[model samples]
Target chain A: MLTLAGVGKRYRRRSVLAALDLALARGEIVGLLGPNGSGKTTTLRIAAGYAWPDSGEVRLAGEVFDPDQATLRARIGYLPERVPLYDPFTVGEYLDFVAAARGLHGPSRASAVARVIAAFELDAVRTRVIGRLSKGFRQRIGLAQALVGEPDVLLLDEPTNGLDPFQILEARRMIRAAARGRGVIFSTHILQEVAALCTRVVYLHEGRLVELAVDGRDAGLEVRLARASLDAVRARVHALDPAIELRSAEALGEDRHRLVFDLGRAGVARAELVRLLAEFADLESVGEATPDIEQALNAALAAQARGAAA
Target chain B: MRGFVTLFARELRHYFVTPIACVVIAVFWAASGFFFSFNALFVAAPDMVSAFHNMSLLLMLMMPLVTMRTLAEERSGDTLELLLTLPVGEAAIVAAKYLALLVILVLMLAGSTLAVIPLALYGTPDYGPILGGYLGVFLLGAAFAAVGLAASSCAANQVVAAVLTWALLLLMWFVDYAAALDGAGGAVRWLQHVSFSVQYLDLIRGVLTRGAVVWFGSVIAVGMVVATQVLRARRA
Candidate 1:
């Protein structure tokens, strides 16, 4: 639903984003994964029409987006990283103001405010001043205001940054629910969040965009076994499929070791390897592996470093 | 237009909800009351010429207080991002804030009219000059409000905004005196042409010249445009 074509941004003599291109489609939750100063926030700000890119254009639904056209730009909702809010305003009042600012009026405005309050579970503190609320509540209100206008596109910067684990889960659910008919582009440093919540993910490094290619056929598995039997387990896995490669092996305290395997290049099913290892070692646990976000990130950065060196 | 109306209303509501507006309004009323009562009871003046003069000066000093937080607070509190991304243009945002400050000025000016009641009761005050004086002060307040908003847009904090506004208004107010110096020449005459005191005194003396009207109009326009441009430059 939104696209940034050859977008570039520079501050003084330094470039923050260079010839970056991205497209977000309806119902797609694209997680912008990058470390600090990776231009993720800059990309979101440009897409939200809050800032002008030094080069290229931003298009919404096939039309070049114009920041001056209030009515047309209201179709996209944005939540900055700081969660811009008026401390003096109550939760309901703030939502009402945002709803009206988006051009909704009278009954529609009231309904929009009420709908988001209910959706984000803000009814409890509806009348409390935002400044007096806790960080978690304030974050929820920020998310609520962005969704109050029911815009077609949502741009959120670290939407779950300050929330606790449960609150983060709630925020993730709220974001997923809000994405039914809208496109979402959210930035964050948490890899697990991207893995759990995103339909697609892209990493940004040194002002360049890199999309993580995940083939449906290739998978990863984690096996926990007695430490002494790790070598036996490895030998058996290679015997089954010589193409299988051990990504990493870590000791689990005194007796057990946890081994991660890249099942991508192997024809052997993970179940067969687990059963064969169980006969020789005391198998503690076996399950699909969570994508090692840190490992992947380090590899990507290292590859970029080598390319620069070459 | 919808965004402008909503923001305008929200700003107006905030002025009442916060303590700063109440304090400013209270201080204005108390000081203006003192000026009027001192003029009537102590100075034994039957006319409102001096009262309007004092009121005009009071507005010049208080307008910065009224407008200091309009844009400066948004910038400091980080709400300007939310505002900029909302489909509202920079011009509309500035206009809405300016209009809200104008409404406060209108209320204060309207309340000051109550002081004229004693003049109508005991003294045979000429209604024409009194009416002209009210118009004069309103225009002066309008010009002050605009300058204050411009200062708020440029400054990093409210105190700096207020100080910048005070410096600018005082310069405009004193330019007339500077033009009367012994060595003053053609350039000084040009400076006097833009002197706020000179234009404002004309309206107080019941001389509604086109030059004076245009002077205030230009000041208001320049202030609004400067404030709008500051917002635009930040986005760029």
Candidate 2:
């Protein structure tokens, strides 16, 4: 529903974002992963129409987005990294203000505010001043305000920044639910969060975007063998399919080794591999393995470092 | 526009809820009351000319407090991002905020009207000059408020906003003396013409000159436009 085409931004002598391209479609939750000073917030701000990109254009539904166009802005909701909120306002009052600001009127405004309050389970603190609430409640309130207007696109920066474990799970559930009929682009430092919440993941390094995965699909299996050597297990796994990729093999001491293989890419059936390993070594526990986004990102960073060194 | 109305109402409600607004209003009433009593009882003045003049000076001092947080606080707290990203134009935001401050000024003016009750009861007072005096003070307050809001948009904090407002208003106030200096030239005449004190004196004296009216309106317009420009420039 939103696209940034060849966008470039510079702060005086420093380039923040350079020729970056990204697109978000409805029902897709895109997680923006990057280290500090990687232009994640800058990209969101540009998409939300709060800042102008020095070059190229942003399009919403194929129409060029203009920051000065209020109508266009109404179709997007943004939660900044700092979670902008008025401390003096109660939860209901703040939601009401956001609803009205988005052009919801009278009954509709009241209903929108009520809807988000119910959705986010903010009814208990509806009358409580936001400043007086706990950080978790305040973060929920921030999320609540962003969804009040039912904007087609939701841009959230560190949406689960300060929440506790349970709250984080709750927020993830709510965000996943909210993305059912809308597009969401959220940036975070939490790798597990991206793995848990995102349908698509992208890495940003040195002012450029890197596509990491398409749908965070289960692409492999992680198996722990009780009486197998790392080299022997690797040799046997390779024998199953010469093209099979053994992503990782670790010696766990006492003749035990853990192996992770990209079974999907290698076209090797999980049962065939298990049967073959069972004949040579004692059977051990095995489970589906989601691609380790952290490992992939570390490899990408290492590759970049090597390129720079060369 | 819906954005303007929503923002204006929120700002008006905000003024009523904030302790700083209440304190500023209270202080203004106390100062205006003291001056009114001094003029009516001690000096035995039959009109509200001096009282209105003192209230105008008091407004020049107090308006900064009323407007300091209008834009500065939002910038400092990062709520400006939320506001700008919403479907609201900068001009509408500035106008709504200025109007909200104007409403507070009206409330203060309404409270000061109580002084007229005692004046009418004790002595014969000219209602024409009293009415004109009210108009004059309202215009002065509106101009001061607009100027204060413009200062708020430029400053980084409330304290700096207030100081910048005082500096700007004092310059306008003291420019009259500069024009009155001997051997002054055409530039001084222009300064005298633009001087806030010169524009406000005629209206308080029961003469609402078109020049004074236009001058105040121009100041208000310029202030609002400048504030809007500052907001736009910050987004860049």
- In lDDT terms, which candidate is top? 2
lDDT of 2 by residue, A41-97 (tens): 999999998888999899998889975678888889899999898898888898999
lDDT, candidate 1, B1-236, per-residue tens: 54788889999999987887778777887888888897778887656777778888899889999999999999999999999988788888999999998888888877778887987888787888888888888888999999999999998799999999999999998887877787887769788888888778777655667888888989999999999999988887
In terms of lDDT, the poorest run of 10 residues in model 1 chain B is B199-208
What lDDT does model 2 reach? 0.85
- In model 1, how well does chain A match by TM-score? 0.78
* Candidate 1 Cα errors over 4 Å, as ranges: A214-291, B180-184
Model 1 Cα lDDT, one tens digit per residue, A1-310: 8999999999888899998989999999998988899899999999988888999889999988865656767888888999999999999899999998888899999999999999989999999999999988998888888887789999999999978999899889999999889999999988888877888778987777877533222247787774456777778777766666565543334534777665543446777777766777787788876545554454455556656988
Report the lDDT tens digits of candidate 2 across residue range B1-236. 53999999888888776687788888889899998887767886646788788888899988988899999998998899999999999998999999999888998888888888877898788898888879988998999999999999998799999999999999998887877677777778789888998888887786788888899999999999999999988776
Off by over 4 Å in 2: A214-290, B180-184
lDDT of 1 at B186: 75
